[model samples]
Target: MSYNSRTIDLILKAQEPNQKQFTTFQQFFKSNNPPPLLFEKNITPKNVKAQRSFSNKTQDSIKETKRKSLSQLKYPEYRMLKIYARIKPGECQLNYDKQSILIETNPYNFDRVFEQSATQGDIFDIVAKQTVDDFLNNINGCLIAYGQTGSGKTFTMFGESSNPGIVLRTFTHLFSRNQETIYVSILEIYKDHVYDLVSGVQDLKLKEDLQLGFYVDGLKKIKVDKLESCQELLQIAEENRHVAETKLNALSSRSHLILTIQMGKTKLHLVDLAGSEKVNKTGAIGETLQEAKKINYSLSCLGHVIQCLSQGQDHIPYRDSKLTKLLMDSLQADCRTSIIVTLSPESKNQDETVSSLKFAQRARFIKKEIRIATQKKTYRDLELEITQLKQELLETKQRMSQTSSVSQFQCRYTTDSEIPCTESLRLTYRSMTNENKENYLPNLKTQENNTQLELENKINQILVELQGLNKEQSLDNVKRQVAKINELTIDMKKTYKVLVSTQGLNNNQLQIQSQFIETQQEQNKQLQKIAEQISSMDSSKPSFNIAINNMIKNLQQQQKQNIEDMQSKLEKVYYDIKKNTTVQDYNLNHLALKLVASPNRQQQQQQQQQIKRSQSKTNINPSVKYLKNKK
Candidate 1:
C-alpha cells in the first residue's frame, strides 16, 4: 500500500503500544534511513529543562558542609582561658558586633558576646556544656564570671530556682553524662578570709599540696552522686554566702563563691566572682566599705595576674591575693578556663564596664596548655564512699525485708475464699507474729466467736431499756441515760479499731470487723423501725410521746453519725485493697524528668537476688526539691 510521510508516522505511532512488528512503507520502500545520533551537544528538548551535573551538586554540598564546620564549635586541642562577654540591659546605649562590644570609641573583642536577652540555658549550651562534655574526656576546666557591681554576674552564674544558672546545669549535666563518683567542695572568700560553704568552717587556711594544687585545708569536701546533693550544697552555700544591700545593687554577693567539682581525675572549678565595685560610687560605709575595698583589691590582684599571664611574663605573681592563691592551679596556663565578663550597659557606669572589658581582653591573650590531672583518690573520699555503700546496703535490706513481708502477707491473707470460716480463722491465727499468736490470737478468736452473740445482747438490752423506761423519771434524766447507752456502743467501736491498728489484727479480725460494721448498720435500721412502731403505738400519751420523740431524734442523729463512721472505715479498707501493687511507676512520674525510671519488678527481683546494689551516697532529696522547685 502507498501512503504519505505523515500517514507513515501515524502508522508507527499507532503501533507503539501493541509492540507488534510492522513493515512501514518508509522502511519497506525508502532508499536509505540514517542511524540515530549517539550523543548531542547543547540540544535542548522541546519544553524541557537541562539537568544539573553530579559535580556541581557535589560542589554545592561541599560548600554547605564547610559553612556548617565554620559555625560549629569544636573541642579545642590546646586548653586555654576563653573569654566571652555578655552585655547587661540598661537605659544607655552600648555598641556591639558579632564578637566585639564597644564603649563609645574604645573597641574590645571577645570569643563571643551574648546579648542581655540570652537565656540561662543558652549560656550553658555555649559555655558550660562543652566544658562538662570535655571534662568527661578527662580535661580539667575552670569557668568564672567577672564583672562590676549590678552587672548581672551573680544572676548569670547563679539564677533563680525557676531559671537554673550554669553551675546547677553543670552539676546535672555531669551526673547524667558520667558514671564516676563526683566530689564537690564549696567555699567562699569573704573579706580576705576563706570560709567553707559546705561545712560552714570559718577562716579556712589555703595549703599547697605536691600533687593537688592550692588545696583548702580542712575544707569539707563532700561526695555528690546526684544533682540534688549539689543543690543542697548550693542552697547551704547561698544561705551562708555573705550578701548585703547597697545603693548600687540589692543582695550583692559580698563574698566570691567557688565550687570545685571532682569527676574522676579531672576537676571543674565554677567560680562566681564578687562584683568589682567602686566604694565611692556604691555609697559604702563601715564594714560594707571594708568589704568593697577588699573585693576591689583582690580583683585588682587577679587582674595583675591575668596581665602578667597575657604579657607572657616569667615571674608570675601568684601570692598577690588570697583569692588568687586559692585558684593557683586553675589560673595556670595549662588549665582550660573560660572567663565570662559581665558588663553594665548603663552609660553612667561606663568606667566599670570598660575595666571589666579590659580584664576579659587580657584573658583572651593568655594561652592554655593541656594539663593532665590524674590524681589518686583520697582516704576521705574512699571512707565517705564506703560509708555511703554501707548505708545503701542497709536500706536495700530494709526494702527487701519490707517487700518480702508484704509478699508473704499477701500470699497468706489475700485469698478469693471467704475468711469467716473457722478453718480460715485458724489460718489467720497461724500467720500472726509469734508473740501476737501466743498472746493476742486466742483473745481475737474468742472475740470472733462471741461477736455475734455480743451484738445480739446489746440489741436486746437497747430494746429492753427503751421499753422499760421508768415513768417517774424526768424527761431530761431519761434522755441522759439513753445518751450514756449510745456512748457505750461508740466506746466499743473505738476499742475494736484500737485492737485492729495497734495489735496488728489478722485478716480474720478485719473480716469480723467488716461483718460487725455491716450488722451494726442493719441493727441501727431495725432499731429505727422499732422506735417508729413504738412511737406510732404511744401517740396518745403526751408526756411519753414528747420523751419518745426526743429519743427518736437522738437515735436518728446517732444512727447517721455511726453510719458515716462505718462508711469511712469501710472505704479505708477498700482503699487499701490494692496496697500490694507497686506505686514506684506513679511516684517516678511525679518526679522530675532527670530522675531515673524505676526498674521492672522482675528486674528488681533479679537484682535483689544478684549483686545487691548500694544505697544513695548523697543526703540531698533531689526528687522532693526538684518537684518543689518546679512547682
Candidate 2:
C-alpha cells in the first residue's frame, strides 16, 4: 500500500488546479484516483495559461520584503516602462494655418522630457544613473532609443568625443565603479535576420525558453575592461551596423542594433533602433526600399505589442516580428526598460511624430512584474550551459594548440629593433584571448583603483574637517580635470588663496596671501607631478581636481578659525600678565653711585654711561624673571 509522492502531489495540485500550490489535502482524499496535472509537473509553472493568469493578478501595490540575499531586492516590483521624449532643435515646419497638419494639441507627457538644448550629461543623469546604481545590486536594465529616421536617435544613444552619448557614458560610468566583471555582445537585426556585429557571424539563430525569454544563439561574447577598450568595440559594431544614404539623412541606420552587456546572470541591453520614415519622403529605392519595408514593419509590430499590453490582451502577438521577440523581456514585466523617443519638429514628419507619441503613451501603461526569481536559468539550462562551457574550454585548448604561430614567435617584415628580419625573437605576452597594451597591465587593476584610494586618503589627511563630505557625491565642474595642467593649476591656486590675506608677518593671516601668490608661479610644476601620477595610473578618474578643490575650501575655513583662535589666546595671555604684575623705574642706579648720591654730577653721568642697552629700557622694573619655591 505504498503511495507514489508524485501521484499524491498531482492529486493535491489538481484540487486547486488554478493555484500555485494545493490549498487542501482533503480534496485529494475524496478522489482515490485523481487526474494528473494538465501540462507538466514543474516547481515553476510552465504553461502559457498559468503565466497569463499570474500576469493578470491585480496587486494592491508594489510589495517590499524585510530581507533578501544575492541581490538587494529579491522582488523588485514590476514598474511601468520609463519613457522619455527628446525634442530636437528646429523651427516648427508644421503649418499652423493648414487644417490637414497632423499634430496633437494636447500631446501625451512622459516620465521626463528633454528640450532641444539638453546636453548628453543631462539625459544620462536623469535616465540612466539610477539604473546603473541598481545594476550593481544585480538588477537587469535596458535602454532603447526609438524615433523617426534622422531624428537623432543614434546621436542620442551614441554621441561624439566632445559630448559622449549614453552608450559611451554608460561604459565610463560602469567601469569607473570597478565592481562587476562585464562581458559584451553586439548584434543587429536586419531584414528580420540576426547577425553578430563583432565576430561578423551572419544569420545567427534565435533561441527562446518558456521562462527565460528570447536570446540570440552563437553570438561572440567579448570581455570588456577599460573605457578605451569599450570604445574600440563599439566602433567595430557601429562600422558593421547596416547604414545607407537617404533623401533625409546622409547616413541612415537600416538595422536595429542591440548591445547586450552580460555580468554574471544579469544583462543590460542598449538598443538603438532604426528611425521610422515615409517611403515617399525617404525616396528609398532598390535594396534601400526593401530595408525600409522591414524596418517599418518591425516598428509597427512594436507599437502593436504596446497596444496589446496596454489593453491587457490575453494573447499578445510577441511572435509577430523578430524585433518584438528579441526585445520581449525588455518590454515585458521582468527587465527594467527606459525608452528615449527622439522627435523631429519638421512638418513633413509630423504624422510620424504623433504616432510615436501615441506608441510611447501606451507603453507607459505596461508594468513589469519583478519576481524574486531574477535567475532566468533553470536546472536543465544550467546543465546545458555547463556542457557548453566545457565545450568552450575544450575548444579553447584546441585553438591554443592550433594557434602556435600566434602564441609563439612568428615571421614579421621587421624585427623588434626595426632591423630587417623574417622571424621575431620576442615571446607573445597575449594568450589565445585578444589583448593590447592594457593586457600586460598590473593585476592590481583587477580590483579597485589603488591610485584613487591613495589620493582620497591623502586628501582626507589634508582636509580632516571635511571627512563628513559624502564620498559618493563628486563635486562637478568645481575644478578642471587633473590632466588639464593649466586649468587645474588656475582652479587650485584660487581655491588655495581663499585662506590667505595681505597683512605682512611670517605667521600673520594677512601675510599668508603673499605666500600663496608667490607659490602660484610654481603651481604648474606641482600640478604636473600630481596629474602625471594620477592620470598615468588611472585616467578614468576625473575627481582628483574636484576632491582637491573641496579639500582646499574646507582647509581654508578651518585655517581661518585656527588663526582667529590663536590670536585671541595670545591677546588674553598678554592682558592677564599685565593685570597680575607691577613695575617701577629709577634714573641710573649704579652700586657705587647709590653710596655717592651727594657726590659730583660727573659720577651720575659715569653711572648712566655704564648702563647696558639691554637695561636701558627701564633702570628698575618689578618684572618676575623667575619664581623660587620656598620649602
Candidate 3:
C-alpha cells in the first residue's frame, strides 16, 4: 500500500476498539487499493433518505462538492504550510494546516489526535530531513517560511522540542559529516543597513567595521568557522531581529531574517520572511506601521527579483532593498536555491495564501545554475619560493666562476715550459750583464743627463706660463672691481640730486600752502560781514537782498567746488606718479613739473579768491539785517 493509505488505515483502526471492523482495512490493504471512504455512511440511512427525498438534495450536494473541489484545484491558490505543535487553552496540539487547503479546527493539537492523525510522519519532519540531506550534499538550499500574521511558520521551521530547529539540525549534520569546512555568518538587513550580530557583544567586543559588501557586492557575507559558531551567531542575530506584536499574531517579525551557511565552495541560504498583511488586518501602529512598510517593501523587492530571474532580465533590482541585495549571489547563478513557502490554513487568510502560492509558482520557473568557486593557492607563497630559487641560482653561478678561475691558475702552473721565448732572452741578458756593464755605463750616464736637463727646462717653462696666467686673472679682477665702484658712485650722485630736488620742492609747497591758508582766512572774514549786511537789508530791498544772497550762495558753492576739484586733481597726480614712475624719463619729468607747478598755482588761486571775496563784500545791502529783524 502507498504511504498515504497505510497512514489512513492506521488512523481508522486506532479510532475503534473492535478488531473485526479493521478487517475491512486489511482487505483494503490486500487489494493494494482503497476506495475513497464516505463519511455519509456513518450518518443514518433514514436521515440520508429523508434528505434525498427533499427535491434532488443528494444530487445537489454531490454537485456542490464537486464544483467546490474543481474550483479549488483550478485556481490552485498558494498557501504557507506551517506544521507546529503547541499548547492550547486546555490541551497540547500540533498544528498542521495550509490556508489554501482547509482544515477543521483553530487549535488543532496533534497530541490530542496523535493516533487519529497520519502516522507515517509529520510533513515538517519529512521536509526538514530532505533539506538537511541536501545541505550535507553541498547543495545550496532555502527553507522560506512565509504567511499572514499568526500563521505558525516560525514554529514549523523551528520546533519547540529539544530536537532543535532545522537550522540546528543542518548544522549538526555539517559537523558530523566532516567532508567540508563550514563558515557561518549572520547579519540582519533592515532598511539597507547590514548589521553584524556576532561582533557586537561587549565581552567578545567584535568591531562594528563590518562592511556590507565585504565579500561580494550586495551580499553580507562574513567568514566563520564551525557549525557551532554559526549557531551562536544565529542566536545572536535572533536576539537582534526586529519584531513587534500585531493583532493577528504576537511577536510578529518585522524584517526578513536570512541565515547564510557557506560550506567549502557551496552556500546555503535560509530565509524567514515576514508575512504580508493589510494594515487594517494586522492592527499595527506607530513603529509597527513603519516596520510593516519595510517588510512589505522588501517582500515586494524579493518578488521583483524572482520575476527578473524568471525572465532572465539583465538587470535584477537586488540593490533596491537590503534583503534582496544580501541574496545577490544566491539569487543569481552562483548557487543552487530552493524556496519553501509557508502559508496559513484559514479561510480568513485566503487572499494572502493565494498571493503566496502565486509568488511561489512564478519562482518555480526561475533557472539559476549552480556556480562553484574554484579554489586556488594564494600568490604570496608562490612568489616567495620563486625569489628563493633565483637567489640560489645566482650563488651557484658565482661559486662556479670562482672554481673555474682557480682551475685556470693551476693549468698555467702545470704548463710552465709552454711560456713564450721572451722569458729565455731575459735570462741570457742577466747572465751577460757584468761584461756589458762597462760598455753601457758611459752611454747610460750621458743619456740620463740629457733627459734630466730636458725635464728641468720643461718644468721651468710650465711655471712661467702659470705665473703669467695668474697675473692676468688678478688684473682682470682689479679692473672689474674699479668698474663696479664707478657705477656705484654714479648711482649715488644721481640719488643725492633727486633727494635734494625733492626736499626743495617740499619746502616750497609748505610755504605756498601757508600763504593760501592766510588768504582763505581773510576771504572767510569778508564773507561773514557780507552775510550780516544782506540779513539787515532783506525785507525792504527784495532785489538787493536776493542778489546778496545769490552772491554769497554762489561764492560758497564755487569755493566748495574748487576745493573738491583740487583734491581730486592732487589724488590723480599722485596716482599717476606712482604708476608711471618705473618708465625711464617719466618719473624725472613728472617730479619736476609737480614741484614747480603746485606752489605757483596755489599762490595764483589765493590772489584770485581774495579779489572775488572783496568784490562780493562791497556789493552787500546795509539795511538787510534791519528788514530781516522786522519780519
Clashing pairs in 2: 78-368, 333-368, 503-510
Would you estimate the TM-scores of all the predictions? 0.48, 0.48, 0.39
Give the per-residue lDDT digits (tens) of candidate 2, residues 1-631.
2236665554344333455334334344346433333333221222323433332331111111111245444554546368888877887653222112235565476787787788899999988877765665566789999999998988898887688899998888899874446899999999999999999999999999776688788889999888888989988988888999999888899999999888767778999999899999999999999999999999999989888988888889899999999888777665678999888877777788888878888887876666543564343554554465455445434433432342132332133333111111111121112233233223212211343344345444333322212221222221233223333233333322321211112344334445444444444354455444433332124675565566546534544454344334333333333344333222222222231222346764554444434255654322111000100
**Ranked by lDDT, top first:** 1, 2, 3
Worst 10 residues of 3 by lDDT: 107-116
Give residue 66's lDDT in candidate 3 (0 to 100).
51
Q: After superposition, how far is residue 537 of candidate 1 from its true place, in Å?
A: 99
Each candidate's lDDT (Cα)?
0.65, 0.61, 0.49
| Displacement of the residue 394 alpha carbon in candidate 1, Å | 38
Task: State the lDDT of candidate 1 residue by residue for 1-631, as single tens digits.
Answer: 3445654455344223233233432354243432112112111111011112322344455554553343243444654678898887657578887589977687899888998788899899987888887666666789999998888878888889999889999988887866567899989999999999888999988888777767788988799888888899899999999999998899899989899988656778999999998888989999999999999999999999999988999987888888888777788844578999988888888888888888988888887664443333344444554465455445434433432333243344344232223333444354444554455434543544454454455445444444334231334444454455455444445534533453356675577587655656555565556545554453325666676667657666766576456545544542353253235422322222212112255653443332212113223233333333533
* Residue 559 in candidate 3, Cα distance off native in Å: 83
Query: Distance (Å) between predicted and true CA of 586, model 3?
Result: 56
Candidate 1 residue spans exceeding 4 A from truth: 1-79, 371-631
Candidate 2 segments whose C-alpha is farther than 4 A from its true place: 1-80, 93-104, 376-631
Q: Please report how far candidate 2 places residue 577 from its true position, in Å.
A: 99
Best by lDDT: 1
Candidate 2 — what's its lDDT? 0.61
